[model samples]
Target: MSQRKRSIITASLLATTLLAASPALLAGNHSSHHGDNQHDMTEMCDNMREGKGHFNKADRQEKMAEQREAMANRLKLSDEQREIWSEMHEEKRQQHEKRMGKWQKKMDERCAQSQK
Candidate 1:
């Protein structure tokens, strides 16, 4: 019935509500669906969080090279096709970066607006 006790109970309830709403806080804004790649990417992220992500640059390159080779084989691309594909891939990568940069800028502007 004390004032201090009531303040403590209110603070605890607010903390619980915030924690429950944490995941929904970032929902819909940043969820990207990459089809079949989503599961593999999630696993890779888990590995990174667990520190088994091969932080060494050389080791990372080796693993990435292997994965790329496997992917090329899976797609059954010829050497000439791979060369052309690489060029197109690079273009797509640049386009993706540009789009993401724009998205980030908009998100920053929205956050600034919200703060005001």
Candidate 2:
């Protein structure tokens, strides 16, 4: 074969080989990433159940306090306005807790039923 023809044939073979290997390579890459994510999520859940998650209750409360202080400062609330804001915040927190409690109970019941 001529040099030009030989070069074209070699390039064609290389391209075909890569195209044939691409799907398996992509699939493996995807599964590896997915597996890592799944493992991380499982570890997070286990840590949370053990009260050791990234943002446990104290961390969350501290963050909320910081946010509240920032908001109060940003809004330049007066003492009375701050009191009102506190009251509203507490009311909303209670409502959220109640709603979450109901949701948790429902989920627990569903889990129990599924185990039967």
Candidate 3:
């Protein structure tokens, strides 16, 4: 009934709702872009089994570059704007790689432990 208690309850509810919806929101976006969820999942599994979980490094880089160009084209960025946009995008990519590296390390550790 207290004001502080009500604020805590509201914050908890907001946090819970966001946590629940985040994965569904991500899956929705991913499926819309990739199409054929079943085929995509099968391909992912095959890649993992083939020890190419990260995919070919060169291919990955090329795909990313292509996507960047597509994005810039879609936005119709000017030269200067494109340069700034690319620099920002590179920063985000580096941050993502770092996070993924940490996640991969943890997953490897877990798998190693399970094997033992």
Candidate 4:
């Protein structure tokens, strides 16, 4: 037929091929990263803290400190970078403490009201 029709047909074929291949391409990429053991929901269910149970605020701070050390080691952070990281972490901790203080005050007020 016309050149325009031929161009349209070629474009349509390319688009169809890509659409057909997309899911398989994505699945392959995802599986390649994790490999063989894909579904971990059964194991994840064992950790209720990860799903529904309330995580302890005290434990969170301790875990964050541990994770920060692990992360610094993994990244091979420089001395200056480590200093900055510590400062950032301290600032975050102070903010968290302030938030917790506000939350405790609210909780105390509610308790006092209920008791009256």
Candidate 1 regions exceeding 4 Å error are 1-69
True lDDT of residue 50, candidate 3: 67
Q: Candidate 2: which pairs clash?
A: none
lDDT of candidate 4 over 71-100, digit per residue (tens): 999999999999999999999999988997
What is the TM-score of candidate 2?
0.54
| Candidate 1 C-alpha lDDT tens digits along 4-111 | 999999999999999999889867644455554556655555554464655344576577567777888999999998898778766876797799678657755754
- Which regions of candidate 2 are displaced past 4 Å? 1-29, 102-116
Q: What overall lDDT, based on C-alpha atoms, would model 3 receive against the true structure? A: 0.78
Residue 58 local lDDT, model 4: 63
Best by TM-score: 2
lDDT of 2 at 12: 100
- List lDDT for all candidates, in order: 0.70, 0.78, 0.78, 0.73
TM per prediction? 0.37, 0.54, 0.51, 0.46
| Candidate number that wins on lDDT, 2 or 4 | 2
Q: Which candidate, 1 or 4, has the higher lDDT?
A: 4
Off by over 4 Å in 4: 1-58, 114-116
Query: Would you list the clashing residue pairs of candidate 3?
Result: none
lDDT of 3 by residue, 1-116 (tens): 99999999999999999999998887655646556755665665556546575756667778989999999999999999999998998999899889978976776675555446
lDDT for residue 80 in candidate 4, whole number 0-100? 97
From the highest lDDT down, the ranking of the candidates is 3, 2, 4, 1
Residues 8-102 of candidate 2 have per-residue lDDT tens digits of 99999999999999988876546678778756755655564565755376787688878998999999999999999999988998897899779
